[model samples]
Target: MTTPRLEGRIAVITGGASGIGQAVAQRFAEEGADILLTDLAPCDATVALVQGLGRKAHQMRMDATSEADCDRMVEMAVQVFGRIDVAVFSAGVKTLPEAPRPGVDPAKATQLVHMSVENFRKVIDVNVTGVMLGSRAVARQMLAQGTGGAIVNIASTAGRIPLAGGGSYCVSKAGVIMLTKVMALELAQTGIRVNAVGPGYTSTPMWDAPEDSDAYRRAMSITPMQRNGTPREQADACLYLACDESSFMTGQTLHPAGGQFTG
Candidate 1:
């Protein structure tokens, strides 16, 4: 029998309720890992998807920004799967920071001014701080278990861009990249690995199109691949971080940007 890539491993994936997170949950389950899926909202659908794959699965409503809640989720993962072999922090929130006042004309050039402090902070709280809390707690657990594991923090190309007043989301993702490096260093002694996946203009339902409800044709035209990526493509990248094929790798960012940066 072929050895499944993630056979017998245990994983905790946050933001598992939808989009990329849901994609990861499905991919991991197919790889033969028991999974604990968490999100701020009910995860019944995700839970069903995983279990339907004939894998052991558990779901819980999680508020990633809460320290206490994060602690509990980690605890639950250990109790459910005995040890966590992989952790993928995929929860994120996005909005154009100074998104011209609702209903404003898009053709008019709007000043990319500083967005409301409250709005900026809110994005940072969930995207950046949440990734930190999840990584920290899971690292502690993996260390105590005496078994090395992998961590995949989802980042974005926006992390490397100015993003106008959409600064909060971009900065938060950049912080995730740096945190992945620092944590890889801190956990090197424990044999655990850490990395990040940076995706650009993915075809997730978050961005809708007029015809097929996909990405704008204009955006796809710029990508070297001439198309946005599927959630599975990004999830496959996460799997590399979770699996042993990347055993020698750590503290890196895997760009699944479809060559958006090259040209």
Candidate 2:
């Protein structure tokens, strides 16, 4: 039998309630890692999936934007699992959840110039600042343990290839990529590795446009693969970066972008 890549490891995943984060939790568990899954939403289903894989799983509710919540989650992970070997910071937002202005098209609302300061700040706070806080807290724990750990931040192809109406999201993901590099450099000597996964047109709850919609069609046209990537596919990328398989890599991004960045 093939040995599990993450055997006996402990992984802490933010945004683990659904979508890419939940998928990462499941994948890690299947690789023999115990999981501490946290999200602003309930993580019961994700917990069940990990438990069904015969791996230990714990769930906690967290607001990634809050520094206290980020620190608390890391503390909880150490308390429950003893140590954290991997961390996937997947908590992020594309736009505000509130309905768009009555007369303005939703697409227009997302344009950089039209975007409200509140909306841009909210996305940055959750996507960029949240990753910073969580990574800081987890890195501290890893440093104290004196054992190396891996951090995988979820970025997006939009960070490199700007989306017409996704300015905030693009900016936030770009920030994440920079953050990953900076953290990796600072922690390289300490044996902690930091990397990013930039997925394009992934099929997740974050994507809700219909197949016939202009947004969906535009996404497909730009993706040479001409199909949305599954959460599992993206999770596989995260797995690579989190495992010893990527020991020589840090301060880099793995783009599972369906050829969106292809020349």
Candidate 3:
């Protein structure tokens, strides 16, 4: 029998309540890693899924934008599990709610020109700042433990390929990619690896358009695969980055983008 890739490892995953984050938690657990799942919402379902996989699981509600919350998540992971071998920063927002304003059409709010400053800032705060804070906290823990670990940031193809109206999301993901490179460079000698997974149009809550909707059709038309990627597919990319299989890799962004943007 093949041994589990993450046997006896401990992993911390943010945004684990649903979608890609939940899938990552499940995948890690199946590979024999104990998990601490943190998210803004409750993660009972995710914890249950991990437990069902016969791996230990814990859940904590976390606000990704708060520095204190980021530190608390790292601390909590250490408290629950002896040490963290992997940390996945997946907490992010595709967009933020906009306040009622004249001349602002809800449908076009995501456009760069129509996007409110507040909404853009919120997206940046949650997507870029949150990842930075989370990764920093986790890196500190790994340094203190004196055991090198892996950190995977969830990015998107939007970072590399601009979307018509996804200005905030694209910019934020681009920031994440650059941050991953910087982190990897700084932590290279420390035995810690920092990488990113830029998934294509995956089937997640963030892309919950009706199958027959024009939005869905347009998205699929651009994907060479002509189908949306599953959360598990994205999780697999993350798994490779987090495991020994990718020991030689750092400061890289894997794109499972269905040929959307070949890098």
Candidate 4:
């Protein structure tokens, strides 16, 4: 039998309820890692999927934005599986405030200037602040254990480019990119590696769009690959970062944008 890459490891995944998070959980479980799934939304589906893979799985409804919740989730992971070998911060808000409505022209839709502070702040709070809290909590546990760990933050290609109507999301992901670097540098001695994966135009429910829709066409125009990325592709990148395969790497971002943003 072929041994799994993550055999005997434990992972804590936030935003485990859906999309990229759900994909990662499934992949990690298949690789022989038990999962501790937490999210603001119900994660029964993901938990069941992971468990079906024959790996132990646990779930907790958590607000990633809450410092207390982040810490508690990490604690719960350790309690359930002894220790956390990897952490994937995939919990975040979509770049666009809302999906394109049918027959609505995105170009003529609400612009940034008309966007509300409430919406912008909410994105930052959940995306940037949540990353900070989760990374910190995971690092703390790793430090206590004295056995270094891995943290993979899910950034976006928009972080490396200027999105016309995605200023808030771009800014937040940019923050995540830099934060990953800073944490990586500070924790190098402790053996905790921090990195990010920047995905471009992934086909997720958050950005629901038909292939013939303008929304999909617009995304394809900017992407050099002329195609949308899949959640599994992003999950694979996270798997690389979370596993010992990238042990020598730290403070780096793996962009799986299909040539969208080379940087």
Task: Record all residue pairs in model 4 with backbone atoms less than 3 Å apart, i.e. clashing.
Answer: none
Give lDDT per model, in order.
0.84, 0.92, 0.93, 0.90
- lDDT measured at residue 232 in model 3 versus the true structure, 0 to 100: 97
In TM-score terms, candidate 2 sits at: 0.96
Model 1 Cα shift for residue 112 (angstroms): 5.9
- The model with the greater lDDT, 3 or 4, is 3
Model 1: per-residue lDDT, tens digit, 22-123? 899899999998999999877889889989999998988888899898899999998877789899999888754344556555533222343566776778
RMSD of 1: 2.8
**Runs of candidate 3 exceeding 4 Å displacement:** 97-100, 104-107
Task: Give the alpha carbon lDDT tens digit for every residue of 9-105 in model 2.
Answer: 9999999998999999999999999999999999999999999999999999999999999999988998998999999999988866435778777
- Write the residue-wise lDDT of candidate 4 on 1-263 in tens digits: 87888998999999899999999999999999999999999999999999999999999999999999998998899888999989999999965454565665666333466555777888899999999999999999999999899999999987888877788899899999999999999999999999999888888877678889988888888888888889999999999999988999999999998787543
lDDT of 3 by residue, 93-208 (tens): 99665666688887776788887888899999999999999999999999999999999999998888888778998999999999999999999999999999999889999878
- Backbone clash tally for model 4? 0
> How much lDDT does candidate 2 score?
0.92
Once fitted onto the true fold, the runs of candidate 2 whose alpha carbons sit more than 4 angstroms away are 97-107
lDDT of 1: 0.84
- Candidate 1 accuracy as TM-score: 0.90
